[model samples]
Target chain A: MPSDVSAPVSNGKPGRLRRLIAARAEGEALRKGNLLVLAVLLLVAVVALLPFYWMLSSSLRMPDQMFANPVQWIPNPINWASYPEAWGAQNFGRYFFNSSVVAVLITLGNLLFCSLAAYSLTKFRFRGRHLSFMLILSTMMLPLEITMVPLFLIVNSFGWTNSYQGLVVPFLVEGFGVFLMRQYMLSIPTDVIEAARIDGASELRIFWMIVMPLCKPALVALAIFTFREAWDLYIWPLVIITDDALRTLPLGISLFMSGYGTAWDQVMAIAVLGTLPMALLFFFLQRAFIQGIAGTGLK
Target chain B: MSPVSSSRSARPGPASSGPKTPGRRPWLTPGSKQTAFAWAILLPALLILAIFRFLPMLEAFYLSFTDYDLISPPRWVGLQNFIDLTQDPLFLKSVQVSLIYVSCSVIPVIPLSLGLAILFNRALLARNFLRSAIFMPVVMPAVVMAVVWTFMYQQDGVMNTILGWVGIDPVPWLRSSSTALWSVIMIGIWRAVPYYMVIFLAGLQAIPRDYYDAAKIDGAGSWATFRYITLPLLKPTMLLVVVMNVIVAMKVFAVPMIMTGGGPGDATRVLPLFIYQTAFEFFDMGKASAMSVVMFAILMAFAFIQVRLFTRKEEQ
Candidate 1:
């Protein structure tokens, strides 16, 4: 026993028996912990997707089967016709086009204006730069509620009501966009700008050629954000756009509810359809979305 | 910012004084012309924000003083809107509803988010997928959430279906005046938690692992380690999260707007929705604007205190 104890002591380590058990226990615990997290994540994923899943599943179920005594997770005979029915019933095609136009235009405008402004604020030395930046930042803290009255009056005064210009022009630019761009631009090295200038590149050329290409990550992230925001927009669009033809997706959903009544099957159909563009966008550009969010946490 | 002020006022023509060195010349670029160009790029954004965001804010202040109808010219009625708002019963109810909504929704989101962040941080596998799934709702449009949730809360919906498995009878969700606020509160939490969770996750990632190792050597259990290590380190992140959450919660419009539309006997009706209704539905811009001013003051006060508290925490 003395010889064995001395043998293990020479290694400056735990006994083989003790080491083995500790290693086994740690492995077991790690496995268990990972399994538990995965399970919880699976549950969360299910919950996150459930509404969308149910919306699709319900949309496909025969109207009679929807209210069946036992809740139906799977519709045995999927009603493919419901899609067309919903489309026709709500004039979804027109609404989809309207939403597409508005969302796309907003995205384009934001990308161009926001990037340019961000470039200037970040790259160039200007007068009242701090004050200007602060003024822009301060605008973000002011509640949109306070601005509603004057915005309405302004839009009304401009006869923008019920028109595309009314829906589009007021939101063509954003303070948040400027603020975000500025932060991102500040991170780019001053050497790059100087290098471009040394090569006889104009400011516009430098921005378009060097800076814009390098800032792809931020721009892509901002684009995804802008697209999502524009797609889901409701309140302002509802306030300004009164024409049924001009109504965006969210507005269309509300109109469907109030005008035709809360037919769950139909509403879910519209709801599911409305979520598709954003859901698809999310799936495609999820990487950029996460990066954008994580970056936001820093500020 | 410092460079901008000094550079602009001191210059008459920037071409000659544009710095002898080629490196500095590009920066000076004729009459702070580069700055002018920068401002030019920023023009559309400024113009829009000025007219829509800032101008309206000023107009809101102005409207608070008048009895302006949507159709007719305004008649000045100083303090009347504020005075009437004080006595108004619906406005009072709206205020109560808003306070309850903010308190219930904003309070749980912070710790719950932190708890979730820790959970995600400790979990080894499927971290990315889990994080993404949880945050999916945050990016989803609020109106769609309202529509989907409206379905879930229906008598025969999935929520009821799940509840029935435990033998609970169907509960009135958005329909019940008594339960409507709570129902909206739940929706608010569901829609919002992911945002805070993402923020907290970032915060959690920033905390170095060595501290945990040191605590473990001291024979601290998991909870003890968390208490001694994680919570204190998380204070800065927590303060920022809470301040942001409170400010955003105070101005919440979309959730309540689409979910309850401030309905079921005005139970879920909050200040923003009240102002919206007064302006759009009732065509009383004056009253709407007045309500907006009152809400802004309340929000500003809350924000001021939140900032002071955060700075105080930092100093300590």
Candidate 2:
């Protein structure tokens, strides 16, 4: 009777019969609650994944079978022709290559430059260091949408429009990247850095040898975040890159949609193609991905 | 964040670290030398941000006053653009539409995401797999998301097909003026909810399990526990999610642009989209910059208030 506090098991407690019934009912109710929670989560997961499933299934379907009634959830024969056809239908190969180079370079640049800056800011007590960090923090508040036209003009003035400079340089060292790195670096004990210094290691050597190695998890998270943002460069590329040669994947996909409005099979193929790099990155780096997000939330 | 504490812990025993040289390099490194080194290391990134981000942000302010369209030299119009916007119906409509869109996307997104995060925070079956499944939407490319949603929202599309099975008539999601803004908001929620859920899940995990154990000993109901314990403790994360969602919703461009093209007569023509058309498509940089100024002011006010509120909470 004293064991279960939830339903108040009744040895001599008032309403003994009712108490026993209530405990049994509470057990049943608990089971039902678990089932209900699972059901709700299942529904949400389905909704989240349905689009990916639909896009992949459509990418494998023939053109005629795409718009068929009853909504083809799975392609019957799983036609693989759309992959090549969509690749060749437009300059998707070029687009893929361009996006890859831009994304990777920007990611590498952020890793090297942001980590250097963050490490220095967190480790050193210097003049205007606080001011410098504050200046960087302030930029995060200004939406790229508000600054888009002016940023475009700035790039245009430098003769960077329609070039890699336009696509990559404007985003190379992000405020958010700097912030993330600095937050992560704050956890690193200064004792280690001091020991390195006493051992006559140069500052650069200390950073490269000691600090960078210890910061691998944070670096992986930053690399993935930076890569995803660079890969998703849509509005800026759309504004600046009017040339077919420099079109990134998102721009390329939009152009594909506009140019081939009726080609759902090909459109879905390109959509799936555009999503896989990011999706695969998420798959391999799921831990860092979640950690990156959680880090931003927590600190 | 104060200099004293950071310097105390971070500064090497400069006297020992400088043992390599005689009088030329003293036994203790000077503070100015460290400042110089910090500036040198930080210079490249600072230079990039100064030229790209900070400069452009200022340019948005200065350019708002001038009538320049990349062709002719600047002509100062000095508040005329702002004055004209007061009478411009389309600009006015965009402000309304943007507010509605932002509000709609954020209000429902907060509760839904937090609730989902709470559900998954427990020790449950298939936890990681279900999390990855739910989080799949946030990782999908925005362009890809908009395109696929366009597919599902077609009049006879999957949305209606599913609705039909529920004994409901097909609803034209993207085609009608009344539903276009809401449809865009729905997709915004679809993508945003899971992302914020992860943030809330992190917040929930951070709460010590001992608090919940204490509540159990006190015989508190689940609702009482959550209301008093979980909700208050999640305040910081909640504030972040709310502010971020608001800002993101204000800048909703590619989705409505691709989904509806602000179609059915400006139903989804949000402020950012309007600014785009004014600056690029129509080549009216003055008016566009003015619109951006208005948008910036509103965002700044929201951000300023939230930050102040957060700092006040910390002080208490």
Best by DockQ: 2
When summed lDDT is taken over every stretch of 10 residues in candidate 1 chain A, the lowest stretch is: A1-10
Tens digit of lDDT per residue, candidate 2, span B1-316? 3454445435564322221222222212336766677789899889999998889888888888899877898799898889999999999999999989887889999999999988876545677788889989989989999998887787767789889899999998899998888888998999999889887887777666678879979999999999889988888788888888888889988888887778879999999999998998998888888899999988888778878987787677
True contacts kept of 1: 0.55
**If chain B of candidate 2 is superposed on the true chain B, what is its TM-score?**
0.88
Provide TM-scores for the models. 0.87, 0.89
Model 1, docking class: acceptable
Clashing pairs in 1: A126-B4, A127-B4
TM-score of chain A of each: 0.86, 0.87
Please identify model 2 stretches exceeding 4 Å from their true place: A1-31, B1-30, B308-316
Could you give the DockQ of candidate 1?
A: 0.30
